[model samples]
Target: EVKAIHYHPENTICDCCQCQMTEIGTTIVREEAEFIPARMEKVQHIEHAYECKNCKADLSQKAQIKRGKSPQPPIQRSIAGPSVLAKVIYDKFVQYLPLYRQVKEWERYGLNTNDKNLSNWVIRASHDWLLPIYERMKNIMLEKSILHVDETYGQIINRSDGKSGQSNAYNWVYRSVPCQGPTIVLFQSSLSRARSVLEGFIEDYSGTIVCDGYSAYDKIEGITFANCWAHVRRYWLKADSKNGRIGVKYCDELFRLEREFKHLSPSKRRKKRQKHSKPLVDEFLAWVENSPFYGKNALAKAAEYTLNRANGLKAFLDDGRIEIDNNPAENAIRPNVIGRKNWLFSVSEAGAKANAICLSIAETAKANGVDFYQYLVKLLRDLPNLDIHRNPEIINNYLPWSKTIQAECVK
Candidate 1:
């Protein structure tokens, strides 16, 4: 066997000694160089200047001279244009990017901003530009034949009365119609009372309202209520998870009926209810009435839920207009819930209010088939220039469902 030598990879290695090169072992040399090129001195030349036409004076002769047209005052550079700003505010506030994150993004683009200033811009844009459209949407929601209502908790820091640093409020969402797509959501800050918020919204309106079993919904006069079967079925399913036979049976029957309902078209559903569903509903009612488990513990609770709200659950079958569930309203409010996860909470009540306004505009624009960004940009720019009396009709032009506006939108 022959012995082979190996060399390690380094900047310098002595081939004979196999020693690593150090800084002490070497010296760096700086070389100086000079290049001589032919050089020549240039002669100065001057041109004759003309006189100013307006002043009839020599212009260039003077060391300092003013031009005829002075530069216009510099228009301040905003981080974004009106349209871009509206989009940024909409995405950050309504779609829920906390301002600090937005500021960091802008910083990456070489623009500096703080959360407070961004918040102020959002408040101003929403209050001044977006609120009118939101109000219009609410008015449209009120006029619909049926409305779906639901409430969710919202937290606001520094709430009224100064009791605590944080307090719970309500975001009450109302959906006017489905498929045709007219929906509205309203946020109201309250200390856990639904009556004040619900009443305040629908005071002038009297129509059929679909909701889950909430006591606050009970007080509205002249408004018919339809309970969500989904809610009742959900409890039965919960009980079924715990291996309750009665719950399983009830849930199976409910799921079968719901499946049947799903198979029918909206118009066919209305007609079929009188012929087919009426009989199924009658059988279900009799089953509930005759069951030995009607007054038992967990099964009894599910039974009572169905029995007590039997009329409301059946109300949807009678009217084709009423939905099988309060899902439309729930769907409308879902974006807010998604946004809240990113935003965490509002800094103030005003911030929350601004958020509501932006959400209303964005959602309504979507419902109406309008491009939200374009619509918001147009509104922000034109709203300030609008004359309240003369421009009353102008606002109508922006309405999502208005025939004239819809025609323009289609075109």
Candidate 2:
């Protein structure tokens, strides 16, 4: 049972006459949310000490002694606890609170921590603690037959040169399609937008990737490309005022047909798409081929854009698993876009890569119905005690889809 201790003021003496003032019985006059200032304390953990004084005095007898193992620090050798690290990760990443802003907040809460320490904890935790989960998510995503991929630009401060903001990078997102098993979004940070990023991402995996018609994706062989119709519609939308009505009408008819196949089984969906949607796509491509417009004309260029990507655009027609567009990948990458505004840029390419790893964990956890704070708390608390190298299966237990993780983190 819990009990409350009520505090009351003592009887006051009159300043002038030294007479006791009237006293009111101790009772709470008001109940309100109390603003208790944050407090910090250094806790000394004492290991049990065992000693036999009689044996110690006896030279012939050996002394019996024992000292317990010390508690592990969340970030090795740092004075931060698991909950402290969780709050730091949550505020900086999930809440998008910048490090400088957090410094002031922590100061108010009696921490007085600088940005460097915070950055150090994040980088170390991300690399040593979170990366295994990232790799696991990456493997699971690559296991799928259909994946959606997209790219977004981000800045990395203090590049190879000393000065900052001299270089740019891309956050490449690879994720499973909606029709797949457990959803996972993996972020990769690359200094260049070269096809090598995609090449290394899907090295041996030969699967259909739905994406926008970027030439980088075209260079990768042994993979089927399904282009985004949303991208195509955006082109038409841009040119709508300038003779894009016909193209817009064609896109509308195509989407209308697509909605009808939403709930159909894979094989059945493919059949329905072939019967009803295939002709519309073929007719749309024909219209583009029949019409001629110069690059200067917006409407003509939109038509030509569709014409050039027609092969990728119609890829979904061959299979039900492939989506008409790569919007899911775009949607998955959007959180990075939102986070880019806050915290602005990463300090280095290495830091940018670390950011990707952490983001992959956060986004993948959300996709798998895992609570963000709970996941970080568990990761920070348990990883210290776990010998991941000795037992490779331990990390698997922490995966978002695992029963342990789900039971602990899913809300």
Candidate 3:
């Protein structure tokens, strides 16, 4: 609130020898920010029935009755509205607030709910409305010519294979290069981190993939693999010796040159790398190959790792569009890792899949610079009205980069 004070004409006279006060510019006295706690509201939809008065009076024909249609709920016969469901998911996935903690928060807002009910709402909403969007994003991401891939471990309370609840499951992430295509980050959950998992996602894809030094990616036949130099740098850092310091210097030089070429076009970047970065790469590889590290020490291990992925480490030099590291995929997968620290393992296989679906939607929304909560609310409130099943192409409009989504959900 703002209150302005003015001098009254009657009070303009001075006490003894006074004159009318001259006008002066206003000044800000004080300012402070306030916080308004969240609150909940209940909405009721009432449908009225009516009968034709004339037909009833005539009594010759039966009176016809008409009823109003109530708007569809996200889930039938459920108290959760689109906004409520969006808040639940946004809290868990984006804010990393577990359902049990949110239970207390919801109580503060005048609602008494448990985590079990919250979990049910999330699983149902993801399966019903969000899965289609996830699938659509996967299809569009695969179409890109360049992608970044990485994986981290997740725990499941119950394994589908009848293993112990503590067994490790994998959360695989795939991200697109914004310079080459739309910004998309997709998370996939797998029971096993086998070569088959990699094959399934990039089935017939022959495009370039920027990844870490994971052997699973090496077995794929038709794809071009550009390994991360950041991982190579990590290896040298672990060596912790004079030789390791020298290796670090070489790696740092390449990165410094890349920073200089950051804004260049693909073709120009490739040209600059060939002229400036290629020689440094060649010299580093030769030094690693001939370095006299006796046993399987850290220095020797670093040399072996670099020599093993020599082709991949040099892959970035040939294409300016390919990133020097898989940092994008790593950054995209970090949220799921953090959330796991809070909620721990998922209870069932379906629950695990639901986690992946929500993560994909949340991360993709963020990557495209959209407000995550707004995007979720928009999808839940609007998607049901669109006929995406009959015409699958209709989902393209809701993708994070689409013009419609940009106009409505971008921050």
> Candidate 1 on 1-411: residue-level lDDT in tens?
334444444667778897876655433344455555433233233344545465545554554434443222111233344655675666774567877778776665555778787787787777766777777677777877788888777777767757565566667777776633555555444446558678887877888889998778775788889998678767666555343455556546654665677756667777866776667767776777677555556666777777878788788888776777788788888877887788777777788888778777777667767666666666666666666346666777777666644655432
lDDT tens readout by residue for model 2, 339-408: 8999788887778887898888888888988998899999988988899888878988999889999999
Name the candidate, 1 or 2, with the larger lDDT value. 2
Q: The CA-based lDDT of model 2 is what?
A: 0.84
Q: Candidate 1, which segments miss by more than 4 Å at Cα?
A: 1-81, 93-95, 179-191, 241-268, 294-297, 402-411
Of 2 and 3, the candidate ahead on lDDT is 3
Q: What are the per-model C-alpha RMSD values against the true structure?
A: 14.1, 5.8, 3.1
Q: What's each prediction's TM-score?
A: 0.73, 0.87, 0.91
lDDT of 2 at 90: 82
Q: Which candidate gets the maximum lDDT versus the true structure? A: 3
The model with the greater lDDT, 1 or 3, is 3
Where does model 2 exceed 4 Å of error?
A: 1-42, 52-62, 161-164, 241-243
- lDDT for model 3 comes to 0.89
Comparison by TM-score, 1 against 2, better one: 2
Question: Model 2 Cα displacement at 204 (Å)?
Answer: 1.8
